[model samples]
Target chain A: MAQARQEDNATDAPPEALRAEGIVKRFGALTALSGVDLHLRKGEVLGLIGDNGAGKSTLIKTITGFHRPDEGQMYVDGEPVSLRSVAQARALGIETVFQDLALISELSVYHNMFLNSELTLKPFPLLDNRKMKERTKQYIDDMGVNIPSIDTQVGRLSGGQRQAIAVARSVYSNAKILLLDEPLAAMGAKEGAMILDLVQKLKNEGQVSIILIAHNYSHVFEVCDRVNLLQHGRISYDKPTSESSVEELTELVVAEYRKARTTS
Target chain B: MAKQAVGGDVGASESARSSPGLGSRVAELLLRQREASIFFVAIALAVYFQSSNSAFLSSGNIRSLSEFTYATAIISGGLVMLLICGEIDLSVGQAYGFAPIAMYLADQTLVLPVAVIVGLLATAVIGLINGVATVYLRVPSFIATLGMFFFLGGVNVILTDGFPKTAPSGSFLTEILGGADWSGIAWCLLIVLLMHILLNRTRWGLHTFATGGNPVGASEAGVKTAKIKVGNFMLCSALGGFAGVLDALRIGSIDPLAGGPNIMFFAVSAAVIGGTALAGGTGTIIGAFLGTVVLSIMQNGFSLQGVSAYTFNVILGIAILTAMTLNVYVGSLRRSGRV
Candidate 1:
């Protein structure tokens, strides 16, 4: 797989799996992302942190191709490309788990897993629900997930289970780069820990890269190899977690706040 | 106790034990599959009518009732699918009469088999138009088909010049398509079973359910929601045309003026009464079949009891409302985490 990806990305290649530079998005009078540059390495988790309206979500959206940047260049596996739609991004192995999770709550777990990519038999080529159900069991077990029934509707699962299923869907879709937007938001303390462990497990597998957005600084520090802080639609802080402490990131935010107050 | 019974999770007793079961799990399961109550209600009505009238349960009476309903039931199968895909085609009623008239017009110049083929193809084209208008033109299907309902009704008058067309008869095909030759029931049952397999066992069926359940979610997951909806529209009209031809052949003439919005309404109600949803994303073919059966039984009972036509209409209206209310209520309960 590594050799094939390298061969396909022989031209205009960058070392990172995904790279974005000078991304600027404007909404008439308001600018959502102003010249933001971010890069994700292979099999590494990058924590994205920001205050309210800090452009973190905007950057994630741009990366997932939900919103196109007015001025920017994006590269997938070293090849420069422009994505016009989320479907296009998915084709290039980019998957995003939005705050809403984009889940059909009324459908079964197995059905949702193969929502758009259902297995079909030859000749007649009808949906292979039995196979999908069996595969869903395998995927969940391999990921150490504890869903009660693969055939049960996703709406019946607990909040964290729902979040995990959404994350699992992205992983199971063969996503090369997974973007999670506040997956732990409003989750119970135990559920939050459970998801963190799952993310850590995916990280250990070393198959897909991760970009996680979270409000909790400690959780970010716990799971992220590196962290980026978005401020006023630009990435203001990028540092390795080993070299930077949570206290230091907190101080940077405080300093930025004081500077804003002084200027105002 | 009841809820757990309905939400039975085999091999997972811990969670089931932790949560109190309030509603009958059996009732809940019955509602989800949408079979138990409709079947029960139909049987109950059948029993009630049998007790009241000596002829109600007679084999001849039952067979005749089925013969009356087979065409509409066939059309309802298609409506059940379309409704599940979150759309409707009111033009079906017109297509039913229109196809036979087209067949009659073509038969004047061509052979019977060729004329029949032309009629079916023409109806398929109309169905394609309905699908394209709704999907590509971005017009809501309800309004687009409503326009078709009126436009096609006007076309019926223009085609036969305001007179019932004398249909060419005594053909083997007509006997199979309609007539009291038992072939009509066989064809209807064959279509119903084929449709049931398509909805439950095919990828197309899964896509239909996904498209209706959540279009955005389905699209994001890579489903072609618009395509599925359009396909269902065509399926609905084609079946509507087929049913129309059957009814015309059985009655021995084509009456454009006789069938209007009423037939389409009856078919839709039959689907809903059986447990197919009006709001989409949920339905069953068996339920729709049962629904048509119940309506047929009720209509037969009313006429036998010597009820006036106007009184029977009121009673039928009440029946539709009660069935729809029950359907919607069961739906809401399911959404609240029972099934």
Candidate 2:
């Protein structure tokens, strides 16, 4: 596996799996991402903290190829690239867990896991359902997630379970960079802890880099090796977990909030 | 370790508790219909008609109704996919009648099978246009298809000189296309069955549903919405054309004016009655089949009972309106998490 990744790493992100530098986006008069620069290192969980309109979503969307920036560039590794669409972003091993989780409610867990990347067999080119079910089960167990059945529809699962399933999908797809938008916001503490542990597990694997967007500073602090504060469509502060305390980050967030309020 | 064991036990029991019994499963298949209520109504109508008049369920009668249903339902299966994905194809009726008419014209002047293939291909091209206009050009499906309907309807009249040309009787290929056997069930039902499996079991089926459920989500998740919609448009139109040819063959004549405006409504009504929604995102192939069955049965029932043909339309309108109302209410309950 390591050797295979090394070969593929010719296109692999260097040190940082994903990077967005000088991103600028405008919607008529309002700017969504203004010269924001951020990068995620391999195997580290980087938290992005911001308010509702803090350009966090826009930045992530830009990085994931949902919205192209008006001016600026994005890099997957050290090599610069232009993401015209989400498919291009996915091809570069970037996967996103949207706030809505992008789950097809009526489909079973196994079916949802392979919605876009379906497992196919020869002759008829039909879906390989049995393999998908088995693979889904293995993934859940490998991640240490407890679910009753792989056949259960995502709609029926708890919020935490759904979040875990989404994260697991990215992991199973061999994603090198994961962008999770508020994955633990709706869950209780037990669920939150489970997700945190999963984050740690990914970090230990040393094959994945993550940019987790959250309003919960404590949760961010618990998991992230580095933290980036987004404000007014730009990165206002970037620091390692060891170098900066939560109190300093909180002050930075508040100061940015106040700045935006005054300017508006 | 003890705590973990207890948790595991609880999880197992939870699965057991929620697991439905065989009876309930059967009930779900029968009564708790996802959208197949329309088909049930068709069956009920058939039963009612048959009970009142022995001839109503006779092989001949069954065969005739099925042939009619086959052509209508095939076009409908494609429309269901379109409607599910938040698009409409108003040109299907005109396209339906015209494709076969083109084939007949070709058959009389040109070769035999070539005519049929040409008709199907022409319809597919129209479908391609509909798909491209709607998906790429960003024209709303209703306006685009409606415009196509006008254009095609005019084109058909011009080509036929206002009268449809007829193919020779007992042509081997036409006979098979319109063939009905021992029980009067048209061979077209086989096509419908094949379509059912394609729409329900394949990756294309999954993508179709996903596109309908949430196109934006589906697209972000890697589904090519444009390609799916366009491909669906061609499939729907092609089926319409195919149905038109089969209908002409079954009846032993081609009528440019026959199966006109009323055909699309029949297809849409069957689709809605089966459980597909105007809002898109929720429908099943079984539901569509059931809806077609219901309409057919109702028509059979009223006719066998010697009811006025005028009253049949009124009765159908009422039935459809009632079913759709119930469908909407049930859908709301599901959405609100009350179901």
Q: Which stretches of candidate 1 lie over 4 Å from their true place?
A: A1-15, A251-264, B1-29
Expressed as tens digits, the lDDT of each residue in B139-243 for candidate 1 is 888989999989989998899998997777786777767865666778888999999999988878888888777777777677888889888887888888888
| lDDT value, residue B74 of candidate 2 | 76
Cα displacement (Å) at residue B125, model 2: 1.9
Give me the runs in candidate 2 sitting further than 4 Å from their true place. A1-14, A24-32, A69-73, A186-191, A258-264, B1-27, B31-43, B179-186, B332-339
Residue-level lDDT of model 2, residues B1-339, one tens digit each, is: 999999999999899768979976665554445754454556566666777788987777876667657766777787898988889899999888888788877887778788889999999999999999999999999999999988888888878888866655565676677633421134446666776777766788778878887787788788888989998899999988988877777677777776667888898888888888877776766666667777777776677788887999999899789878988787666555444
True contacts kept of each: 0.60, 0.34
